[model samples]
Target: MWELRHRGAAARPGGEAASPPREGEAAGGDHETESTSDKETDIDDRYGDLDSRTDSDIPEIPPSLDRTPEILKKALSGLSSRWKNWWIRGILTLTMISLFFLIIYMGSFMLMLLVLSIQVKCFHEIITIGYRVYHSYDLPWFRTLSWYFLLCVNYFFYGETVADYFATFVQREEQLQFLIRYHRFISFALYLAGFCMFVLSLVKKHYRLQFYMFAWTHVTLLITVTQSHLVIQNLFEGMIWFLVPISSVICNDITAYIFGFFFGRTPLIKLSPKKTWEGFIGGFFSTVIFGFIAAYVLSKYQYFVCPVEYRSDVNSFVTECEPSELFQLQSYSLPPFLKAVLRRETVSMYPFQIHSIALSTFASLIGPFGGFFASGFKRAFKIKDFANTIPGHGGIMDRFDCQYLMATFVHVYITSFIRGPNPSKVLQQLLVLQPEQQLNIYKTLKTHLTEKGILQPTLKV
Candidate 1:
């Protein structure tokens, strides 16, 4: 059954085998065709037996608390798949949006936890796919090693985050200080242990398949854990940096679906057959506008614009800082063409709102490629969805494939353009240094500043 499924998946959509017989092999084509037909008959008989099995043999879809309400289900029972899917997606989209807002209101810590949870779920979903496809469940220590690697990777990332952002808190705790000081080395050691375990557990017959799953586990970790770490990093920069990009992706997804549902005429891509040019175009404009407005509104609140910081005194994370120039309103003279339309010569806008254009544009334009890549992956595996975690959304990974891509872009954008040398981060590092080393660094900085005329030189007296 597994071989048949894999063979079908390997075949091209054009009804050609993945590897056709060579020209030189034409003499044996008749024999090959006869053998292939015999194999097909055997496959058919096996499939018949499989389908004849009792319902109990089939796995049930995992129950979700957020399944469609029965009343709405009845009302939509008569609708076609297209219309029914539209309603399901729309309703669940709003529900997820509401949950997102609630998490935002709860603050950055909650947001980080949420990201971590999503990362784990995505990792699980992908690893589960590997297990199902390769039948690797019987492999010794494979599951254990996969989870061990996940822990090692997460420990490395979150440890760095704590060391960078919670230096003061770490300083207060001697245990945490030691962990933070050698975090990378510890992380590497942990991973090495897992690696040794994997080597030891390798079976002679399954060596190639075991290595494939090992690569699969690492790739999944790279996608889910590494990208999620970046998302949290963006959040720490400022809630606006995180929220705007994410919300833009969500907006584009919804607006695109709505437009495509109503006006789709031209197909956008082969991987995602349902995507259309109308949706793509409509989504772009809607996302940009939505991002602009969201940036403007979020900029008004210092809480949204301030970088998140860990306060040892307060014993919790805090978002409190002087708003940066990015958030500050600045006046710009309108172009001659637009002056008449706006009936004004100048307009006041937050610079971040201008940056939102790039974010929204990437979210709408390049972001869909992430989804396309995921779709291709699913097609390769002959799966409809990753899992039925969300009633309409398939899995956490399905909804977040584009989000991971967007988070990466946002992190790059901040580092490349917006972020400067952070004095606080430097100070945090300095605080971890020995007293004599800190004094030397302070003296060096003071001397440099004095030479530069930024600080007055003191007399030896």
Candidate 2:
């Protein structure tokens, strides 16, 4: 029976063999005494019929589309299961790299579109799961209400983005100007409309399910959409902000898998059985080095180092700026041990890359807990993956489970530690105000400047 189970586990692609008995549990040993014989017989009685069944009694499982390739099938049949997984993962990695380069070449706008696209897909996967679970409950307009809420939220966020970043163009259109003027009021109205519709659609028996799904959708929005907005904010700071943290997570994920595949033995956590301590530690060092190197390479490019600024004269997002201290190379004193071993007194490094070490460490440590959280969610729902959007990587949510957490961390880190006053954004906001409001701000600024002696009192009036 044990041999049959082992053979079945080996035949499967993921190598989920049953765990062996611990050190003292061998058959016919002193451990199985007469006193325990009755208990053992009761266990056998419960499942003894299964041992009599032949292999023919079990139905053969059909092949999936993924296993249709003859070469892959033969390799899986011949090579080690780990090797087969490596081959598939390697191909997927290459494909992802190709897509990444293509998007990067297309520039920041394309990357924004890609992010928005992923957000929509992730939202779809999550909402679909909700629908599938509650479909039988026969709730009225559940999916519609969820989508309406999504639209309302997106309208509010995107409307804010346009008003803040595209102030010049917005002033040109009377309709947009009016909308921007009453943006907050209009957004609130839209949300209220959706809320009313949901309340009206609530059926008597399905009220509990409807409310549960409502909360689920909102929580999903908070988790996926809100974090994605932060990611877009990171992108506006510089593509590097969006890229480095994301890349660091991806690097950590890949390196962890690689290390774990070859070296992992002891399980790291109950939530994810495949995770191991060896992988976590190995991935940490590798991600740190990779993050530093990537940050260094990106700092040299103006396209990455400069923030995304709108130029009214050119009517486009422009990248042009003197490199900030974060990107500039600065010397740091080395430790005494390093100074003695043919090392220089100081090492020149980009301050941004130094920060990348913190980001990478978070990605390696705390970021994965986000994935584990998703894993627990899936287990509770009895699903394998979120959605098979990526052939090997599961859903966008699955792939970006860590990235979302990393994105929020990067955004907060920048806002708290790195970001300075964005005179342009502030100026844009000021421009969006009414003429009277603008005048008040102008007077306030003038008065402040005069008090500071930057503006002469005689020239003011």
Candidate 3:
């Protein structure tokens, strides 16, 4: 039996320790298979079971994502109705219009203060835009220096100094007469500016280059500031020197913008895609016609009707100085040129009116360049606009870019063309004449005065 079992065991692949020399394990029997099953169960129990778990780290979104749209709708529904919007808009509009008049009422002083700020803003934007366009300046010093220089420009241009300088240099009449008499200080100021810039730019050896940018910055500043100077001077001089040019520029910008937005059909240039040919045509024509009307209305046909100082003070100085039938002439030494201007001022607190027509015409024809230049600059930098400070407009630069150049034009026009060589030039010319000839002219002038009996009898001498 033992021999037979050993033979059977040898025939099997595994021993008793491996599962089965039992019933059903050896052959195929029913209850014998139960024993084999029991053995397999016991063997399985000896080893520990593994707990099941998902290996995925990503979470699947449930239907909860659908809530987003509903949330947004509910939020929007919370806002005020259309009536409220209208009320808000109306209030804002009224506020804006009132502010505009207030600014105009402040007159030249307000305009000048705003101009100084605008210049600094303009220069800095150019520098910032330049960096993006060219990738040239990367150093901190360059930026700092530029800002510093801009501040200097703002200060210099804010006062009478700049206009005084413009009179001295750029607008210097062929006859050597300046609109304002003192210009030496203005010249000195310019030199100081140049030196300051030179020294400031010396940081990090970013020297000897980019004259185009350099010139552009200075010229823009100089031009804008000088315009302010002229306008302010003319304002104080009791003239509407500023009103004409400012109005013309604003009119051009506003008209073109409105027309272009509505009916623009053809692009004026690739750089300025929105400024249409139609807008240009409309703006130009409107500006020209307006110029003529403005000229007539403002100048009152170049005839200012106003009561004279003497008329107002009929009882004051005239009555007091009627003694002895021969006056001391008030010991006045006002140069003939000054006398002429004073005489004019003496008559009116306002200036000549002809500039309105002249300005309107000039602005309509040549002022488009201001818009074009700003457009080109914006395009060059791929910026949507210079800035968003103004509502419909972009920034200080956008509003005033053309004005800068226009101021130069007007200043030049008034100083060189409109006013003619200042009445002062006549005096300068008189002073330079040969002594004998000048003496004869003087004697003739005195003789005429005496003949008119305007001269006092001075001891019959």
lDDT per residue (tens digit) for residues 1-461 in model 3: 34544444444335432233554444435345445544444433432131121223212211111222344346446566543333433444456447645765664456546555666676655666554443433332455555555655545444344333233232335433342333456545765876676566442223333343465556655655565555554443222455567667777776776577678898987767777888888888777667655544544421111111111223210111211111111233556788787764232212233445567767866777877787876654456666655433455677677777677777777567544333433554565456899899989989889889999655755
Clashing pairs in 1: none
Better of 2 and 3 by TM-score: 2
Best by lDDT: 1
Q: Which pairs, if any, clash in model 3? A: none
Cα deviation at 217, candidate 1, in Å, is: 0.6
| Per-candidate local distance difference test | 0.85, 0.81, 0.53
Which candidate order results from sorting by TM-score in descending order? 1, 2, 3
Evaluate residue 35 in candidate 1 and report its C-alpha lDDT on the 0 to 100 scale: 60
Off by over 4 Å in 2: 1-81, 433-461
Candidate 1 vs candidate 2, lDDT winner: 1
The window of 10 residues in a row where model 1 has the poorest summed lDDT is 46-55
Candidate 3, backbone clash total: 0
